[model samples]
Target: MTYILQLVTAGLAVGSVYALIAIGIVLIYKCSGVVNFAQGAFVMMGAYLTFAASRLGLPPVLAVTLALVLMAGIGVLAERVVLRPMLKAPVVAVMMVTLGMLIMIRASCLAVWGPDPLAFPRIFPDGALELFGVFITYNYLTAGVLSILLSLGFLGFYRFTAVGLMQRCAADNPRAALAIGIHTSNQVSLAWAMSAGLAGVGGTLLATLNGLSLGLADIGLIAFPVIVLGGLTSLGGALVAGLLLGLLQSFTDGLLSPMIEDLLRAHTRIYSVGALQQVVPYALLVAVLLLRPQGIFGRKGSERL
Candidate 1:
């Protein structure tokens, strides 16, 4: 029971980070209709930026803040420079541009930070809290709590604030928004900025959990299965799917992998199931796509071109 609880706690922590990053992907998709493949790049950059700032003697909080602000600015700039110009281009072109942006960001990071993984500074205190036989570290708790808070806050903003209303209007119908005098272009840019900032936070939290590395960007790819499972247009779906994927991956990593390996070992020549956790999401994604393409909590016909 303790072991199961431990695994659950760990999964929740990691899953929260996935949910946060997934939300960013959904935000960009909803606002601009372009799938931003560079989200992983943004995540990678945030971790590196946090690392750089920490090395410069900034506290972890400050370092994270600096990274978030910088990433938000980068997102705004990206909208202006890349997305804005390509507004008239095909959706395929915008996607390709985002992919190209990912490569460029990765190359730049490699040139500056090199290809080595660095130990991220610990923002939370060491050791775990014992509660009813379950042990959870401060890091996990912090990540989970912060992810929830940020998600709820963003949801509230979308529901109440004027800017958020404008964003929703634009997302719901760009032509209607423009016809009604809402600055759809500016709203789109704001969406990019907000999405990038959220991605930065997601990246920073992930780094704290898994350490800083170029591979961090790959989290964006992992997010693809998550959003697909949750539905492309539903914010609530993203949150649920992110958490579900995270927990599924964690449980697979902790319990299922070993069990499968043991069964294979006894029956076959295979000695290991390398990175089984990574495969789970894609499998789930395929199943979701095949069975219910609308996704959990997603509306039918939401996949607009």
Candidate 2:
């Protein structure tokens, strides 16, 4: 029981960061109808930029803030320069462009930061909290709490703000939004900006946990399964799905892997069932795609034929 609690706690902490990044992806998809494949690049760039800022002697908080600002600017630039021109292009073309952005950003980071994982700058105070026999590190506690708060805060902003209403209008029907005097294009830009900012913060928090590396960009792969499971258009669904996936992966790593290994060793030549936890998300994705294509909170589209 104690071990289970420990795994749960650890899962929720990592899951909160996943929720943050996944929310950003959902935000862009909702507002612009563009699936951003460069999201992982934004995540990687955010961590690298924060590292750079810290190296220039900025305080940790300030470094994260600076990274967020730069990331938001980059988002807007990408929207205007890359996506806006392709607005009338085929969806496949736009997706390919985003893939190109991802490749370009990764190569740029390789050239500038090189191909080495840097030690992440310390953000949280080093310590651990013991409660109910479940040990939690300060890093995990702080990151989890902060990510949840930020996720809830962003949801609140989207639900209650005027700009958020405009964003929703733009997302629902750009022509209608334009007819109503909303600047749909500006709303799309804002979505990208906000999405990038969120990803940047998520990346910074993730770095504090996993160290800085180019591999951080691959988080987008995990996030894709999350968004698909949660409903691509539903931010709240993303939050819930991210946390659920987190907990599931944790349990698989902690419990199922050992159980499976033992079973396999007992009956067969296999002494291992490697990285089952990593496969869980994709399996879940396939299940959701087959069983609940509309997702938990997503509305099914209507054909107007």
Candidate 3:
């Protein structure tokens, strides 16, 4: 029971990060009809920026705020300079541009930060807590709570504001939105900014949990499986799917991997499952594609968010 509780807490923490990133992905897809492959790079940049800010003697709150603000500016610049000009191009071409942007952003980070991992700044109080027999650290708890709140807050904003109404219109039909004086380009830019900012926050939480490193960029790919599972057009679905995936991965690692490994060891000579936890998302992805390609929350006839 203790072990199970531990996995649940840890899963929620990691899943929160996944949900945040996936939410960003969904936003871009909705607004621009183009997946910003650079979403992961934005996450990486956020963490690195935080580190740089800390080195510059900023406090945690200030550093994070500065990082997110800078990321938003970067997002706007990316849209205006790189993506805006390509608006008339094919969707695939625009996606490729984002891919290029991802490479460039990553290269810039590598050039600046070097390849070694950095110890992330301590944002929460030190020590751990035992909650009903489950142990959780202050860092994990803080990250989990903050991420969940941010995600829910974003949802509330998306669902209950006039800006959200405009956003929906822009996403539903950019051409029609433009004809109706909606400034779809501005909507697209706003989406990028919000997405990048959310990813920055998520990245900081993840770096606190997993340490800061270039490998953080790879963690961004985890959002793909999440969006696919939740339905490409459904932001709420992405949040749910991200948490579900985190739980799935946690159980796979904590329970299934050990049980399977024990069985294999007893019956044959096999000793490991080749990162079984890591494979669960793709495995689920295959099942999802075969059975429900539109995702659980995705509408069948329309691609509306």
Candidate 4:
């Protein structure tokens, strides 16, 4: 029971981070009608920026803040310089450009930081909290709590804030919004900025847990399964799905992996099943897409001919 509790704790912590990142993707999609695949790159870039800031002798909090600001700027720049120009292009073309951005960010990070993982500065003090025999480190606890708080906060902002109302208007009908004097293009830019900022913070928190590395970008890929499971248009769904996926991955790593390895060793020549947890999200993604194209919380779209 204690062992199970520990796995659950770890899973929730990591899952919260996934939720945070997924929310950003949903935000961009909602406002702009564009799927930003480069979100993961934003996550990676944020962490690297934080690392760079810390190396320049800034405190941890300041480093994270600076990185977030930089990330938001990058997001706006990408929208203005890349996406805005392609407004008349095909959807597939825009998607390809986002993918290109991801590759570019990854390559840039590799050139500037090298491929080796760097030690992330301690954001939280060193310690562990034991509750019912489950040891949770301060770092993990802080990250988990912050991620959940930010997720909830962003949801509230989207539903209750003035800017959020404008954003919704723009997303629901650009022509109507424009007729009413709302700048739909600026709303799209704001969406990208906010999304990138969230991704940055998520990345920084993840770095606190997993250390800084280019592979952090790959972790961003997990957000897709999360958003899909939650429903791409549903922020609340993203939060729930993120937590669920996190728990699923954690269990696969701690319990299922060992159990499978033992079973395989006794029955076959294979010594291991590599990174089963990583495979689980994509597999789940496929299942979700096949079983429920509209997602758990997403409504089916309708069009008038």
Per-model TM-score, in order, reads: 0.97, 0.97, 0.96, 0.96
| Model 4 lDDT, residue 98, Cα | 94
Candidate 2 per-residue lDDT over residues 1-305, each given as its tens digit: 99999999989998989999999999998888788999999999999999999999999999999999999999999999999999899888998999999999999999999999999999899989999999999999998889999999999999899988898899889999999999999999999999999999998999999999999999988998898878889999989988999999999999999999999999999999999999999998888878888777776761100
Question: Candidate 4's residue-wise lDDT over 128-224, tens digit each?
Answer: 9999999999999999999999999999998999999999999899999999999999999999999999999999999999999999999768999
lDDT of 3 by residue, 1-305 (tens): 88899999999988988999999999988887878888899999999999899999999999999999999999889988998888789878987898898889899999999999999988788899999999999998898889888989998888999788889899998779889889888888999899999988888888999999988887667888899899998999999999999999999999999999999999999999978989999998888877888888887753422
For each predicted model, how many residue pairs clash, with residues at least 3 apart or on different chains?
0, 0, 0, 0
The best candidate in terms of lDDT? 4
Query: How far off is residue 187 in model 1, in Å?
Result: 0.6
Candidate 3, residue 147: the lDDT equals: 85
Residue 44 Cα positional deviation in candidate 3, in Å, after optimal superposition: 0.6
> Model 2, 208: alpha-carbon shift in Å?
0.8
Instruction: State, as a TM-score between 0 and 1, how close model 3 is to the true structure.
Output: 0.96
lDDT of each: 0.90, 0.91, 0.89, 0.92
TM-score attained by model 1: 0.97
* CA deviation > 4 Å runs, candidate 3: 301-305
